[model samples]
Target: MQSTVNYLWHTDDLLGQGATASVYKARNKKSGELVAVKVFNTASYLRPREVQGREFEVLRKLNHPNIVKLFAVEETGNSRQKVLVMEYCSSGSLLSVLESPEHSFGLPEEEFLVVLRCVAAGMNHLRENGIVHRDIKPGNIMRLVGGEGQSIYKLTDFGAARELDDDEQFVSVYGTEEYLHPDMYERAVLRKPQQKAFGVTVDLWSTGVTLYHAATGSLPFVPFGGPRRNKEIMYRIITEKPAGAIAGTQKRENGPLEWSYTLPITCQLSMGLQSQLVPILANILEVEQAKCWGFDQFFAETSDILQRVVVHVFSLSQVVLHHIYIHVHNTVAIFLEAVYEQTSVAPQHQEYLFEGHCSVLKPNLSAKHIAHTTASSPLILFSIANETPKGLAFRDPALDIPKFVPKVDLQADYNTAKGVLGAGYQALRLARALLAGQELTLRGLHWFLEVLQATCKRTLEVTRVALLFLSSSLGTERLSDMAEVRGTQELRRATELRTQLRALAEVLSRCSHNITEAQMSMGHLSSELAKNRDQVHEDRSIQQIQCCLDKMYVTYKQFRKSRMRPGLGYNEEQIHKLDKVNFSHLAKRLLKVFQEECVQKYQASLVTHGKRMREVHDTRNHLRQVGYSVATCSTKAQEAQENLSKILDQLSHQLLQDRAEGAEASLLPVTPYPIPAPTDLVLHMQELYEEMKLVAFDLQDNNRIIEGLNRVPSAPDV
Candidate 1:
């Protein structure tokens, strides 16, 4: 084929192909320089028509070290083909690097940092030029290899790039879904109202995702399986907290833990690095586009942590100590620095031992007696220089270190030890002292735990005794027998009243059981609430508890409404036999009968019977009060149970949705405890029911007295 532009086409060097474009390795015939030629198929409607020429226009305006440079563009009228010649990246794209066998899991943190810095620079350049790289993913990031782990990554593929006005929101949902922000999806597909257009922050989010991929060969949110899975992924992106999304991430066997959204770094990372990196990732992955970090903010924040080197100092005779604050890379200078700071010896007087992990950091023994030791791990150890080993032989060995106090001095010595440990010391003596102090503290805590356990057991025992006393009081019997009823009409009326009382007692008893069942349910629910509150954000659990309480309140109101039923209320008009129920009149009438019929013989027995009758009467009144209490308490307990169920259901739903570790077994519905409220009510109600039954039986047996006391009952209405 004839040359379309100044560059001669190398058709045989087929680089790569997309649906709408074909890229080839080409050379400028005049300069004999290698370049990439992308020829767009204008006939394909898949790509926007504006993209055919806008990419070249955008690339021409951009000039940055990390951005690919455009040479020239040519269009053939006959073929209707548009071709653009641009800079060639010999090492290919970052996609290749990630897919390579050597780096399949992910690039090392150091190497990935280089890639990130370059990408950020390129994107910043684009932003400065008022352009947004709509499709910023791994395939578009090109890499050029250089010497000694040095590589220049250039942002390529401007086909989807667009220039926007300030404060503009990108309305289109065109980028890869995994990288797209939730708001963009909502605005484009879901059509959620009040959604502002996404801007450069979109790029920041995509970059964060790209960074995550570089650090770990996986996406934070991946679409899996079929149609249902797609929706689930979308829903998760919208609702679930990003930190929780990375719960299933596992650390690689050889490399760092998967740098996920929750916790990006591993425990092996120094405190300083962790402090720096956590904030950076948070800024980038923030769901709100407006809040995401700009390139300048990202670079400024991450520069220190990314560049800082950790130095692990080990005293061969003592324990290993990690020092991360040191910025100086030169081992001799660092060694001298550490000598003055860490030990009480001078650099010239001390002989140091240094070991290196990488080629650049190899310790040159000839220069400073530093030994070249290779380490498979990233831990870099530097030994404290020993000055005069023989001089220590003259010093008293026992006096050299302080003895551990078997008993901590509560005054001056304790304060001094506490201060020393709090400040922390590297000396072997101090470390040993700290260990001894810790042991003492642990023992103290153990003693405290034992005391607490005893206290709890004692409290439980006291509660049990109180419950037993309360329960026993309800079932106590009176020491008496029932007097006889003499009249048929009086006996019939007493029997009817007794039958009604028994029915009322049964209803009250059922209420007690209901209340108890509810209370037990709520008790179990409270336990579940305690557990779920720990795993989730406190706010969510708190809100859930409030909702349950609200439901319980409503249920309680309903129960209270039921308590006002006419059957539960006492009706004075419903009482038929007032003479039998009126203890004052019955006592006078019974005394008159005793006086008339063999007064001398029955006088002593009459006194005992009167006392017993009064006791029985008082017991019956007490049973009535007990029944009322059971009804009221049972109502309250049932309401509590409803609330408890609601709270438990909330917890169960959260547990299932979150699928938190160790929660798989909780997928089944929560089975509430057998509530004590109803059972306690049952006990009280049963006692009242039995007591009332006895009162009714006695009243039925008193027919003789009831008739004899009211002799004119059959003659006329007295």
Candidate 2:
């Protein structure tokens, strides 16, 4: 490849190439600014001078953000070839992005939307300036990363573009074969003779094809053989089939063609977006020029879609209770306004937490930013203003009853009760076993007695604390009162509480008795072990300590209802509900009511809204079909009128010929026939188009209603 385009630009890298020109990434000699230089080949210059300069003129006239800007025109230093310096898009062409493995199925919904808006806006600008882009494909659209890290798509490669009015016609066939109109494809690719003139609607066809490829990662029409290999079959498919009737075809060797009409499951666009997109594709992808949508209608519909908000599921207390449809451009404050409308919680009182994030969303942050951060899960909104909203007032009647006893400090009680029995038993066991069968010296015996007395004192202190804890916690006053209540649930709870208290008290009493017996035997064991006279006292002390451990273990086993414990077994800290706040039962009741009032109602409303949205989608689709029928009828009607006029002219010419031959006397009087115009059919088509627009508007309005509903606040979790 050539290393330099001109003395002014160093063309070390080739960006892309087309039949007419090759684009290169170049740097200015003086400024060092990176730019793309489009250098036309000798064949391009061989075309008419007007055709060669049209792209430069078109780019110079356009100054829109969505359209690529032209910098300057220069001549290559080597061949003196024309070079167009244009804006360098750092992110490359959209076609390059789509070819990546991640986007093999299609551009993700967000990226696709960006392409849709940019292309629509750029084409709208072109229409306003009476310019037609004969070629509109992903390869011709460039992508740039904006300062805020957003993707911006811009229309580029306007070589096939030209200034053409709506009524004016051009016979030139120029565009990629797959995105070309059938008339253009027949003449340009298949090398077929053509007399049909192309209007601005041809651009619409290309735009639709481009959008379909962007959405689905494939062309709308394809045969067993590719477009180039089977050009005649491709032409037949484009002309014979209705728009969107068949998406693509697949066939095995010598097998029948399998046609797919619906988008594949791999398509990433949501059903809601697809519903809006399908009608637009249907109207613009029409093969017949008369049935296709004009740029004005196309702009109107696309702008409407861009303006509409994206729907996001909002969850409260981990339960999905609402769907928020706020525009991505809207700030968190505006989103809060929508939330307020649904939840009746003021903006100041609402705290929005995105999934996997602890920090609440800032009020000034854009919804688009939030969407990017929390793309994996629904946003969770907590209402700090209302614990309970109106119309969902519910209080457990059982909670109204006054507490019959003071609340127990569970942590304090559990700490006191933990080592009461275990410590006493350990002390007695150690003293008897370690000194067994050995005569203790006077000093050793004294030391053993002292340790025993200290152990006894500590055991008493712990026992006192444990007894106090049990008496305060397991009092019968509350349980007795609850048992007298008429409600079955209350009565059952009271019985359970009574049984637990009784079992605990019995075990503590037995363990305390055994400990007291063991303490008394410790003195006897000291005398016997010191004199080395008998093992009787040592065995008795061991037996008393063992009995205490056994009692504690049995009680623990009964409490746990499992045999997974070792040693003295496990002890669970009992939670005494001494106050009227029965949180466990109250939580269950509140959850039930919450389900009935909030979750279930929201679900029902969602179902209804979904049905309505589908209805509107169907209505828009029907309206598009009606518009197609009307356009076709109008075209036929105009053709018939033209044919009638020709017939009349031929008849008049024949009469003149006869008169010239001196046979006028033999001819009968002629009658003038009335011919109908296609004005009514055209009017009907306009009406249907208007109806489709109205349906689109209504669908947007309904989306707002579906995003929010009057309902209860989220119930607090226990």
In model 2, residue pairs whose N, Cα or C atoms come closer than 3 Å (at least 3 residues apart or on different chains), thus clashing, are none
In TM-score terms, candidate 1 sits at 0.43
What lDDT score belongs to each candidate, Candidate 1 first?
A: 0.47, 0.58
Q: What is the lDDT of candidate 2?
A: 0.58
Which ranges of candidate 1 are over 4 A from the true structure?
A: 1-3, 10-12, 43-51, 76-78, 147-149, 187-195, 223-231, 242-275, 306-718
Backbone clashes in each candidate structure, one number apiece? 16, 0
For 391-444, candidate 2 gives per-residue lDDT tens digits of 111222222222222433333322222222223332332333222312112222
lDDT of 1 by residue, 134-177 (tens): 77888889898767758999998887788974477666665666
The candidate that achieves the highest lDDT relative to the unseen native structure: 2
How well does model 1 score by local distance difference test? 0.47
